[model samples]
Target chain A: MKSNLELVNDCDQFPPNRDPSFLYRFMVNGFDCPFGYLLEATVNTFSWPDYWEINHDGKTVKLLGSSLEERNKQIHDTLLAERERGSFKILKGWTSEIFSVYGPQKDLVLSIPRIAAPLFGIVTYGVQLLAYQSDTSDGAIRIWIARRAKTKRTYPSMLDSTVGGSLPTGETPFECLIRESAEEASFPEELTRTKAKACGTVNYVCRTDERGGGELGLFTPEVQFTYEMELPKDVIPTPGDNEAEEITLMRVEQIKSALGKGEFTPANGCIVLDFFIRHGIINFENEKDYIEISSRLHRTHAFPTA
Target chain B: MKSNLELVNDCDQFPPNRDPSFLYRFMVNGFDCPFGYLLEATVNTFSWPDYWEINHDGKTVKLLGSSLEERNKQIHDTLLAERERGSFKILKGWTSEIFSVYGPQKDLVLSIPRIAAPLFGIVTYGVQLLAYQSDTSDGAIRIWIARRAKTKRTYPSMLDSTVGGSLPTGETPFECLIRESAEEASFPEELTRTKAKACGTVNYVCRTDERGGGELGLFTPEVQFTYEMELPKDVIPTPGDNEAEEITLMRVEQIKSALGKGEFTPANGCIVLDFFIRHGIINFENEKDYIEISSRLHRTHAFPTA
Candidate 1:
């Protein structure tokens, strides 16, 4: 069985050989308020369009547009052109959705197409909800777990949190959670809004794997707003969309076993481990790596974040 | 009012001018497994006792002792000599307690006297418990808060968690929590052992401030094991020792006001914030720095920890 710390490290893989020299800071303001990390290959291969500036000496990339609108258009046009020419395979997964990027002052610097986020190693935000119900007789807690549909592009047929989705350009994490809960888990909006508690967040800087369906070495720094909802046993969640193939209630021990067997997606495993820690199932006496596991779930990064 | 992010930043003060060049790594096991950070001034001023070597070129400090026993003795003897000579004012607060240090592999590196830890910028561990109860009529939560005795050396007269203490060399966080619950809060050992739930941990690399009662700019990387207990309404906590001057139950709103007013110790403020976040009193919609505050509470550091 994998140790809890190993499970966390798998999600937050900071490679020992990750060379800082090959990274270009994604600068927004005149100061070094970096929002993303651009690889040397990415900087060298991309044709420098009119609004983009690359400082070779400083290893920094900046948008030269005078306004946010122009900056957004500059990225949109460049990625659209890349998709049209089939220059970068990553653009093929474009969903036409945009993600808001923030600078040091917490101002929205610009929005980038969802497919192009990993290309610049931008920080992406998401919401994940772990819906559980109590077994009143035994006083045990059982969580609602979802299995992604085999037809899904990433982590297909793998276990996931009950509800999860990326935040749209202007959506708050709470708003995103409400929408995803209804779409993915057939949960009532009122039920979710009233009961779901924003527990905390899980953060990681992961290098995209083959399962992520992206270019290798793509840096994906992510912040996942985590929530927990205790559902009445009668209000069972059914799959409401193709995102999930099936949903089931899992006891704590079963979830632990699945986590050890690597059945859940890396990010989902981290969320589950965090849930267990907060619920006092996996604790100091039971897990030797308790402190390390808890701390690693909220890893810090160099870039600016919202 | 101070924002939630500001409360977190107050505890995790990573100065902009923190220079890596002036810091020396504590090396062990033929690798760069640093257990502490040594400032240049600390390196230059300290007399190099036997079994201790300073590599000026590499900016590294290593213990040349053949075994852990010898390494422990080397540090003990050096600090004892410094104390006798009245060389460092920090030695005045020595409690004769030792804190266990760990290497990269989580192996026990060595133990250092408590007061000498910050001088070497070593990682320290502690246990903090927030005991609370629910208002039967409204279902509102009220937490037991303690004011540190004015006679206390550190953070005197400031608010603190219900039960807290530093982890001694051989004590587990759970054991320490149990002991502190009895000594600091006058709670029965059995009640604490059965009721307290290990929520998670809060980590930060903080520079010592005036209230810390140490030399300025002392790097104190800390990991606090946090736990929470739901107490029955009839059972109120009373001050059992001189560590606390008073114990009172405060509603969530009152706690928030106090937190904003900076009535709590820096570390205790962090613990309270963590409690509020976990209990859902602080949510994504209510706090603008939701993700930033949650992630910052579990800040990552370079030094090895247990």
Candidate 2:
């Protein structure tokens, strides 16, 4: 009997009838437990170093790399070749180069393609800012949204928030918000750091890179720290980088229609839902799952048990 | 592999080395699918009636009662007897005589013991209101908190919010708030119905009532709609009933200290945490799990598909 919380979290995203044994916990040093899972097929082909143990008896494999440097280099090259081979399309410009290695208490940042994260079931974090007009005579909220450039390998030309980007290694979520605002929207640091209120986040997991086929892919879990920044009535976002095709202000109703049409990234839709709830645009009486949807956006697996 | 959402929702409340099969789904009429799971031991004993079938092949059971009235009565009597037999301890004053039957769409209300809900894995909803000072000089918030009456059946003498109650049969949540506020805190209707803003909810499932012995209990899933009401600095909460021994104003720091000492009920602790996050008292930078905790309070299983 799974908890209601777990059932909601599951979202029926996993393929039914999948064998649990097909995946093994991807354990890192000092984690005592796995942060994520690695496919058994991948493990069978790994030429482990003498120090690393393939503990089949314990029904678990240990990545006792000769050193952190050695492990990073191998995982990096392996995933990079897979990407170059067209195994999984990587979103250019939007890609996070520094991947996170989650330990028991703290996380380690290594220079690796973010697209390669799921191989070890490692987690990722990002920032999505909802820049909007603060005053509207009609009591309607208008948000500045961007459309990803068509050149993007994934979700190209999809609608996104005013500003968004993956969290670079060693940057705080707030700092990332400031940097991303400047890169994506050409916003000044003062307006972003001062007026951008830290709202919350929307998180979910997706089964990634199925190019290896049946029962083989990386599990990518993500957490995005969200912000709500007010834009001066006359201010408009001009793209500072080529990542966005266009940035424009749209009424909440228009955005809602776009969401219904699936014009936004699934994650972006969830963030807008959070936005509606926070801005008093949605209430429990109107949406039965209002509470459920609001809370589900913030579930954190950033720290997995050992 | 579960979605990161479900993984975060799980929070692994179960004991180590626990068997997943110990739990079974709790289905209702037309819900053909599982609402949640009950302990397997409870299901093996039911000589299910004609309309209902125990689908051992699917490793689940179905509840297809002829009518809500009939099903409600059966589950009610069966659980009441279990309680009388001392299978588990009942909270003295907090027993819910009215039971809730949630289907795919709307929920049905029936007269049944609320405490018996977990035995069948039913999910319940309640309203909790936070009455606070309208103005604060130091930006330090003060709230009106109540201490439960010592003579109450469940969680006697524990700390609670200013006003809280189960949603009565046929009452809207807002109506329930107005009603409960008057009943619990002698709050004025005009003040509550007009000023009390529905914030959101905090949801979780816990295995309470340790009839299985030593850490094992029936899982109770709950969703509480939280509210924030502003009170003039001169106003005070006078208990309208015996539910609380005292209702007094306490600084947020005092509540935090009480939470640290475990003086508040487990559920109240969660409600307060939600309050802190919403009020901007807790920030993502300060609390590592702040965003995670903030979002998890609202995961709902209301619309489980058949």
- DockQ, candidate 1, comes to 0.75
The interface RMSD value for candidate 2 stands at 4.4
lDDT of 2 at B280: 50
Can you give the DockQ of every candidate in the order shown?
A: 0.75, 0.25
| Candidate RMSDs in order | 2.1, 6.5
- Give a tens-digit lDDT track for model 1, residues A137-236: 7788999999999999989999999999988888888888999999999999999989999898998888888887767887889988999999997898
lDDT (10s digit) by residue, model 1, range B1-306: 887778888888863225566788777545566777887877876787856889999888887776789888988998898888877778888787998888777788888999999878888999999999876577888999999999998889999999899899888889999999999999999999999999999887788777766677878889999999999878889989999999999988899999999899888999999988887788778887777788789776666677
- Which runs of model 1 end up more than 4 angstroms from their true locations? A15-19, A29-31, B15-19, B28-31
Q: Give the clash total for candidate 2.
A: 12
Q: After superposition, how far is residue A54 of candidate 2 from its true place, in Å?
A: 7.5
Fraction of true A-B contacts recovered by candidate 1: 0.77
TM-score of 1: 0.95
TM-score of each: 0.95, 0.77
